[model samples]
Target: MRIGKQNQAFTAIATSDSETITVRGLDLCDDLIGKINFTDYFWLLVLGDKPTEAQRDMMDACLVAIAEHGLVPSVQAARMTLAAGPDAWQGAMSAGLLGMGSVVAGSSEAAGRYLAEVIAKAEADGTDIETAAIASLQDHKINKRKVAGLGHPQHSGGDPRADRLLAIADELGVSGRYIETLRILGKHAPGIIERPLPINVSGAIPACILDAGWPLEAIKAVPLLARAAGLSAHLFEEAQRSIGFIMSHKADEAIAYDGKTSSRNTKAAE
Candidate 1:
């Protein structure tokens, strides 16, 4: 069966021939390989153009901020996978990346969408961003929904990474409407939700990157790319020290089987 939308048989991202490779209209070897850094290359690859100094800086900062967050579930999963296989690094990486869902590295994309919705609500209601933020947050509260990017389980006081990224965005003069909306949400979300919901790095990332001209669709890419590096490190360590089995054993010890008792066990006990 056909999918929802018609697929276009083309990709403007890259092309290759016998002689040379081209990416975003630049020769990969001649014009881009050494001339451009990975951050700039990432921007070009995604947005079809090179990043400005501020964009590059903002992107770089975000990447660094989210790259390695100690033994997050994804990292744990990757490390464990590597320990199990011992040779299949690619599979291990895939295991890690596959876990980057809405609750993990992908939360930035949700936060970006949340910010965009606030902007849209403001424009629609003919109110300021702050008012729109309040209304949207209230709606979320009424529906008993969690606002993305507003809280961190580990950093209840506040996410330091979030603070740093927003500060960086301000320094780069990219703390525009999206960042404004994010701040408004941060200010109001706690009061509406009747709890402390300070912004986290996930929230900060979307606000900074969206304000810095990144598309909302690609917000998740930042964390994914950064976590790839983190996963590599964990996988290397797991290979050397062999903690995958240790983690598996720890998990086994931690979780108790609370399901229905077996019939054989009941008969034997009787």
Candidate 2:
């Protein structure tokens, strides 16, 4: 039996024939291959239109800012997967991508949604953005919920990448309500959250990109695409100077076992 009601598949992304290929209604070879950068192509593929100069620059900056993070857990997982099965590079990449959950590389999407919510609440209540942000932060504090994209254990003083991204957004003149919301959070977060939780890269990424008109639903795609580039590099190195097994060995050495003893005397156990 058929699975669903639809009789034919549909996609506006691309199509190919004997002589030519089209992407978002543009000729791939003649119009895009040599003319557009990957970041612009990415924008066309996702939003079905090319990005403005500011949007493209902001996107490129974010992609570069998040691309590699020096053997983060996801990188380690990818490396270890490669070590377990040296020939399966795709499997290793999948393992790495799978590790990007709420706590790791995926935090950008969460922050984007939070920023959107604050903006929406302010618009609904006819209040200023800062007031709305403060209220949302206070609510998170009371509920013991994390205000996503506001802290980094390693960058306690501040995250340089975040600082740089925000600066670029400001310089490009793309800073908007979301960026303002993020800055307001940074300013008042200590008072509400009771800690100096500065704006992290995750926060900066969404703020800048959203101001540049990226959809909230696809916020995660930015980091995912960027990390894929990083993962490819890690996998390439794994093929040559393999460290997957080394990481596994270190993990084994680091974790201590503290289980129950065998049910017998020492001589019997021996």
Model 2 bad stretches (over 4 Å): 1-9, 264-270
Off by over 4 Å in 1: 1-8
**How would you encode candidate 2's per-residue C-alpha lDDT over 1-270 as one tens digit per residue?**
777788767999999999999999999999999999999999999999999999999999999999999989999999999999999999999999999999988999999999999999999999999889889888999899888889889897899999999999999999999999999999898788887698999999999999999999999999999999999999999999998888888889999988866658556868
Top model number, TM-score: 1
Position 47, candidate 1: lDDT:
99
Q: Each model's TM-score? A: 0.95, 0.94
Q: After superposition, how far is residue 169 of candidate 2 from its true place, in Å?
A: 0.4
Top candidate, metric lDDT: 2
TM-score of 1: 0.95
User: What RMSD does each model have against the real structure?
Assistant: 1.6, 1.9
